[model samples]
Target chain A: MTYTGHLQLEASERYGKSVLSDAYYNGVFKISRPTYTDENLPLVQLIHVGGGYVDGDTYLTEIHVKNMAKLAVTTQASTKVYKTPHKQVMQRALYKLEANTELHMKQDPLIAYKDARFTQETEVHMDQSASFFFTDSVTPGWSKEGTLFPFTCITSKLKVYQNGRLVIFDHLRLKPDEDLMQLLQLEGNTHVGSLFFIHSEVTVEWIQKLRDYLASFCDDQYGVSLLQIPGVCLRILAKRTSLIEKIFAAVEEFIHSTIYNRSAISWRK
Target chain B: MAMTNALFPILQLSDSQFPSGAFSHSFGLETYISNGTINSSASFRKVLEIFLANQFVYTDGLACRLAYEGLEIGNLEQLWQLDQSLYALGMARETREGNRRIGDRFVKIVSTLYPNQVFDQYNMELKNKNVFGHSALVFAIVSKHLGIERETAISSYGFATASSLVQNAVRGVPLGQTEGQKILVDIQPLLTDIVNRIMLLDETEFGIGAPGLEIAQMQHEAIDVRLFMS
Candidate 1:
C-alpha cells in the first residue's frame, strides 16, 4: 500500500503560556497530543498505523515549528522495511523551523529485512537562529536462515539549509553486493547510527564532551566531528543493535542535560 | 590522433611537485599506521584499494566532475553550490579543513600563475570567505581553465590521489620504496577502471557511503600524536 503522512505544527501564546495552536496529520501517520512539562516543551510521537512499509510504498511528512516554540518528534516504534521483490519503498520528509524555534527528532532505527530496498530523504530548512537535533539508526533484519545485512540497498540522504544556502548535505547509500568487509565500508559492522546537531549556540566544549562521551563506549566504533556549520555530527558503528541504542540514549541524555539544562524522560513503552 | 594542447597542463598539474600541499596530509593513513592496522604490504594495498573504491572514487571524483561541468557552463553559482555540497559530504572535521587548505593553496598558486578572470572571481569568493574551497573542485577548475580534456583531467587526478596515498604509506607504514612502487603498479589498472566508472556515474551516486573510513579519519583527530594533518 502507498502511504503519505503530513503534519504541521504551530505555536500560540495565550496569557504568556505557549500552546500548540495547530497540530495536524493526514494519511497513515498519527501524533499524540502535546504533553507539556514545566518548560512548555511539547513531546510528540509519530505513529504509523500499519506498523511498517512494503513494496511500492511512498510516505512524505512535513513539519513546521513556529517561532519561539520547542518541539520533539519521534516514532512510536522502529520503521521496518519488509522484503520488496518488485519495487522499492520511498520516504521523504521536510522540516521548516522559524527563528528561535527548536526541533528534536529522535527517531527509531530503520530495519531492512532481506531483499528489502528502502530509500529515505529528509531536508531541513531553517533560519540562522533556529536549532535542530536529529538522529537516525539503521539495522538490517535477520532472515529465516540467520543471515544479516542481506538487504538489496538502502539510500538515506539528509540536507540542511539555512537562509536559502545548503550547509550540510549527507548522503549514504549502501549496496552490500561487493567488498562489504573492507576498511572503507561498514568494516564488518552490522548496525550504524548517525546524529546531527545544528545550533548556533553550540560550542567547542560541547563537541569535546560529546566526543568523550562517545569514546567511553568501548564496544562500538564512533566518531564526533564538527560540521561545517555551527554544529556537530556523530557516527557510531557496532555489531550489536543494543550498542548503538545505548549510544543514542546517552546522546539524548547529553543533549538534554548539557544543552537544554533539563532532564530527559524515558518515552519508551 | 592529433596531440591535444592541454596535455602539458594536465601533466604539470598532475605532478606531485606542483606544490598543492598534497603531501602534508595523509588522509587518515597516519592513524591506521599509528594503530598498527596497516603495517604490511598486503595490508597497505588492501587499504589503498578500499580508499580508492569506496571513498575517493565516489566523493572526490564526483565533486571534480561536477566542478568541471559547472565551470564549463561558466556557472559560478553552480560551482559554489557544488563546493558547499562537497564540503557537507565530509564527515570528519580535519578532512574538511584539510581539503579546504589544499584547495585554497592550489587556487592561490595556480590563480597567480594563470591570472584569468574566472580564476580571479573564484579567488575573490575564497577571499571573501563565502564558500569553502575544496581540493577536488579547485583541481577541476584549474584543469578546465588550462584547457585540459575532461577525461585526461579526471584520470590524472585519480592517479595523483593514488600516488599521494602510496607515498604516504611508504613513509608512514615504512614500506620499502620499491614495495610502494609495486603497490602503485598493482593498482595501475584500477586508475583507468575507476576513472571510467566515475565518468559515467550519476549525480545520485555522488556520495557513496564509507562509514568505516570516515570514523577512522575522525579518530585521527583524537590520537595523542599525529604525523599528518588528516
Candidate 2:
C-alpha cells in the first residue's frame, strides 16, 4: 500500500507556528510542523507504538516552506525499518522553499534490517534570498541470524533548483557486495551523511567558517567544500551512525544559533 | 596501413609522458590516503578497480567518444554542448577545474603543431571564457585532427588513462616497478571491456553514480598539504 502526505507552512508572525500533520501508523508516525516558535524552538515529538507495523516501503512525505518565512522540521525518534518476506521499504521526502524564506530539516537516523532495500530522493527549490539546510542519516539492518545482511543497497539523490533552473545535483548508490567501503568508494565508512546549504549571497569566507565549524567534530572522517554554484556541501563518512547524527545535530544547532538568531534579533523586536 | 596509422595517433595521444601534467594530480588519491582510507597497496588497488569500473567507464570514456564522433562530422555545436553538459555534471570545483586545465593544456600543445580552424576557434572560445575546454573534448578534437578513427581514439584514451592511474597508484602505494606493470596487465581485459562498454553507452547514462569519487575530489581541493594539482 502507498501513503502520501503534504504539509505547507506560511509564517504569520515572528514566533507563530503551525503543525501540518502528526499522524501515526502501525509503528511509524508521520510528524511534520510547517512553522515553529523561534523563541523556544519547541521539539516536535513522534513515538513508535509497540506492536505497530513499521513498513517504510511505499511511504512519501512532502514539505513546502513559503516566502519570507522560516521553518525547522525534524523527527522525534530514530526510525526503524523492519524486514518483510515480500518487499523492501521505500521512503522519500521533498522540500520546497520560496524566495526570501528558509527551511532547516533533519531526520533522525534510520536503521534498516537485513534484506531491506531503501531509496530516497530529496528535491529543493530556492529563490535568490532563500536558504536551506538538510541532512539524512542511515544505518544497516541485522539479519535473522543476528548478523547484518551480506548484501544491501541504498540509492539516494538530491536535486537543487535555483531561480527555476537546476543548479546542483548529488546522487549516491551503495551496494554491500560491491565493496562500497573501499578507499575509492565510501572508504570503509559504515555511516555516510551529506549536508547541503544553498544561498545566493553566500561567500567563500562564510563557507570556510562553516567548514571550520563542522571540522570541530574530531572523531569522524568528514570533508567540506564549496559546490560549483554559490553553495556549500559537507560529507561525513564515519564508522558509527551516532557520530554522524551528533555532527548533524550540532550543525543544525549552529545554524539556528547563528543565522536564525541574528534574524530574530533584528526582526523579532 | 590505414589501421596501423589509425593506431599510431592513439599511441601518441594516450602516452603517459604526453606532458599534460596528468601525473601531478592523484585525482583524490592523496586525500584518500590522508584520510586513512588507503593505507596500503592492496587497498589502493581495490579503490582503483572501483574507480575504473564506475567512474572512468561512465564519464570520461563517454565524453571522449562523443567528442570524437562530434568532431568527425564537424559538429562544433555538439562538442560545445557536450562540454557544457560535462561541466554541469562535474559537481566538484576541483574536478571541473581539472578538466578545463587539462583541456586548455592539450589545446595549447595541439595548436602549436596542428593549427586548424577548429582548434583555433575552440581555443578562442576558451580564451574568451565562453566554454570550458574539457580534456576529453580536446582529445576528441585533436585525435580527429590527427586522422584517428573514433573507436581507436576513444579506446586508446581509455586505455592510456587506465594505465596512467595504475602508474600513479604505483608511486602513491609505493609498489615496485614490476608490480605496477603486472597490475596494468591484469587490468587489460577489464580495460577492453570498459572501452567496449563506453562505445555502447547512451548520453543519458553519463555521470551516473559517482558520489564517492566526486566527494573525494572535492576534499582533495581543501587538503592543506597535497602533491596533486587536482
lDDT tens digits, residue span A109-198, model 1: 899898999999999999999999898888988788787678899999999999888888888887778656667678878788899988
lDDT of 2 by residue, A19-65 (tens): 33232333234443323454533233334433222344465556666
Weakest 10 consecutive residues, lDDT, candidate 2 chain B? B1-10
List-wise, what DockQ does each model earn? 0.80, 0.36
Clashing pairs in 2: A26-A52, A57-A89, A57-A90, A112-A141, A113-A141, A181-A188
Per-residue lDDT tens digits for candidate 1, residues B54-79, read: 67778898778888998888887878
Q: State how far residue B92 of model 2 sits from its true place (Å).
A: 4.7
- Name the runs in model 1 displaced over 4 angstroms: A1-3, A11-17, A217-219, B1-5
- Positional deviation of residue B23's Cα in model 2 after best superposition, in angstroms: 3.1
Tens digits of lDDT, candidate 2, B88-175: 5666667667776777787788677556788888888888866777768766776787777676776777777777776776777667
Best by DockQ: 1
